[model samples]
Target: MNGAPQVQRRRGFIMGFGAGAVAALGVAALIAAIAGDFSGSNLTSQASQVIRDEYFKPVKSSVLNDASVNGIIRELRKRYDDRFSHYLNPHQLRQFESLTSGRFSGVGLTVTGVKRGLRVASVLPRTPAQGAGIKEGDLITAVDGRSLAGVPTEVATARIKGPPWTPIELRLVSGSGGATRNIRLKRASVAVPVAVGEIKRAGTSKVAYVSYATFSQGAHGELSSTLERLDRHGAQGLVLDLRGNGGGLLNEAVLSASLFLAKGQLVVSTDSRTMGHRDYDAIGNPLSQHPTVVLINHDTASAAEILASALEDHHLATIVGTRSFGKGTFQEVIHLAAGGALDLTVGQYFTANGISLANKGIKPDVRAVDDPKTPQDEALRRALAVLAEKMAVENR
Candidate 1:
C-alpha cells in the first residue's frame, strides 16, 4: 500500500526562451498575435508548441497537434518513452492537488488488484474503512454491486474514492476463503501523516524510530517537528524508515534532509538542456547528530532516493535494506489558462555524490530482506543492530 503518491516539487516559473535581441522582438510579435486567442484551438496549439520546444528531448512535428489532448499525451508516451509526462484534465488536476496537499476524500483503504478482486493491503486508522471493519488481506470482490474481478487497480481505487459524505458499498471476503460480507461506508477527508515516530529500546540505548511516509507539501515541517520531539525525549540514535515511500515534492526532500545534514551541505543537483543546472543546499540547523540508520527497500524512489543518497554520500547515516526504486528525473507542473495542467518531465537530478539514480538506485551499506511469512521486520531489526554498533563506536 502506498501512503503517499509520487509527485515533484513545483517550479515557480515555466521555462522561457533565450533569444537574440532581433529574435526576441520577432517572438514578442508572434506572442502578441496569439495572446488574444483563448479558444480551445489556441490552447491545443499552445500545448503542442510547448511540448515541441521545451520537452527534454526533441519531438517530431507530426505528433504535435493530435485531435485530442489525451491523444497527444498517449502518442508521446508510446513513441518517446516518456512515462512521466501527462496531461491532467480539470477533475484530475483537483485530485492531484488534493493528494499532494496530504488530504483526500476516500474510504482510506489501500488495495492491490488480484484475480479475485482488489486485495486490501492496509486500512488507515480512524478512516471509514477501519470503522467498517476492513482488514488487511481481505479480498474486495465488488463495489456497488459491480464485480471488480478483472478491473485494474487504478480504476478500482478511483471508484472507491468520491466526494466527502458520499456512500460507497463494498463486498469483501475475509483472507483466503473466510466469510464474505458487504458493508457501506461514507467517504471522508483523510489527512495522512507525513511522519510517524516512536522511541524504541535497543539494548540499553533509546533509538528514535521514525517512518517517513511521503515528501508531500509541509512534509519537512512535520518531519522536523517529529525529530525534535523525539530528540527531547532522550533518544540516543535514529532509525529512519523509508520503505514503500514512493516520494513527493523534491523541495520537501531537500528540506527534510536539512533537518539531519549540516547547513550549506549540498542536498541534490539538477541538469537539463532547458532548465540548465541548479544545486539545492541544506539551509537549517540539524536537530540531532546522533548515529543514524536509514531503512530502504525496492519501493523507495524519487525524492525518497534523493534524501537517502544525500545522507549516504555525506556519511551521515548507514543505509540498510535492498536497493531503491530508481527515479532520477524531476517534473514541473505547468498550469494552463484553459484549465487542467501539463505535468511534464523537465530535468534529471543527481545525488550529492553526482550519481544519477535513473536506472541505478542507491545500494545499501548493510543489506537485509524481510521474510513475509514471519511477523518480525527483519530489515528494521537489522537497522537497529547497525544503529547499536554505530552508537557503541561513538560512545567509545
Candidate 2:
C-alpha cells in the first residue's frame, strides 16, 4: 500500500461503499461474528436495541443510529485527541460526495451563515439563482416557509438543495436594513468549477492565472489542461491561486503537483498508524517551465498546502500572500455498517522537504494581506508582481 495502486484502492473504497440498510447490517453482523460474542463485545448495538424496545417515548431508528455513531466519534475525539475525526450522516455523506464530484442540485448560490440568516457570497452564472436575480450581499432570511435564523450554513444549504426540477423559495434581504423579498426558483444540477484559469497582464508579462476552489475529482486534469492552454496562448509566467481551498482527494493533490514537477519527484509522504508510510511522487511530464508564483492565504489548507510546499521547497514558485491554513492531517472516510461514515484522521502528511504543516503553516515568500472591505485584491496584485519579477529574471 505504498504507491498509485494504494491511492486507487483508497479512492475505490470511498466511492464503492455498499448501499441500503441490509448492507450495513451485514457488515455489523460480520464484525460481531469476528468478535465471537455479540452480547459482550457489541454493547453499543445491544444498548440501541434495548432503547428501541424500552424507551419511554417514541424514537426513530435512523435518529438513534445517527446519535449512536456520532456519540462514538465524540468519545474517540476526546479519548484520542483527534479533533478532526467525526461522523457524517447519510444526508451529509451525499453532500460530501456531491461536493467532491463537483456537482450538486441546487438553486446555485454560495452562501455563508450569518446571525439572522445566510449571506449570499456569489451567484453562479446561468443558474436558477442568477436567473431569479439573486445577487451577492443579499441576505437569505428563510428557505421555503422556515426561518433560517440561527441555522448553520451547511444545514441551510442542504435544505436549499434537492432533486433537480424541484421548486424552492427563499426570503432575501438586499443589503443591510433592506426590505425582505421572497423569490421562488427551481433546482437544477450545478457543476462546480474546481479549477478556473485566465491570462492576466503583469507588467509586460502575460501570466497564466489559475485558481483552484478544491482538489476534487478531475482537478489535476483541469489544472493541467488550463495551464497548457494558457501556455499556448503566450502566457510568460504563472500565478497559481489557492486562497480559500479546503482540499479534497489526496490523489488529486499528488497528480496536481505532478503537473509542474518533473517525473519521479517527491510530492508528499504520509505516515499513518495503520497504513504505515507511503510516498507520492510526480508521475507526469511538466506542463510548462514558465516562472511561477503561488498565492495562498489563511484559508489555503491540506492538499493546497501540500502543492504549495512542494513548489516552494523545489524553488519552482514564489509563494505570496499570508500564511496558509495549516492542516497536515489526512482523513479516511470509513463507511459504517449502520449507515453514514466515520471521517477518521488516519495520518499526518509531510511536505517535499519533510516539514509537517500542522499549526505551523506555509509562510509566504512575499507576504501580502487582502482587506475584505476593499474592492482591490491586494494579495493577488502582490502575486502578479512576484510573477512579473520571476518572469523578468527568467528572460534574463
Candidate 1 — what's its lDDT? 0.79
lDDT string, candidate 2, 1-396, tens digits: 112121122112311235566457655754454345344656777767656764678788998888887788778868876556768788777766664343458887766556688777557779999999887668899989999875434556677877789999999998545878999999999876877899999988787999877787788988888888998989988899887676778999999999889999999999998999999999978876878899988667889899999999988989999898788898888997767777788999999999999878899999998765466988899888878877777778
What lDDT tens digits, residue by residue, belong to model 1 across residues 1-396? 123232221322222344466446645655554454434466667767656765789986644532366677778867866556767666656766754344448887655556577877556789998899787668899989988764433445666777789998999998755899999989998866779999997668998999988898899998988888998999999999988677888889999999888889999999988979999999968886889999988778889999999999999999999998788887788898867777777899999999999867888999998765466988899899989988999899
The true-versus-predicted C-alpha distance at residue 286 of model 1, in Å, is: 1.5
Clashing pairs in 1: none
What TM-score does each of the candidates earn? 0.69, 0.72
Q: Which candidate is the best by TM-score?
A: 2
| Candidate 2 global TM-score | 0.72
| Candidate models: Cα lDDT each | 0.79, 0.80
The ten-residue window of minimal lDDT in model 2 covers 2-11
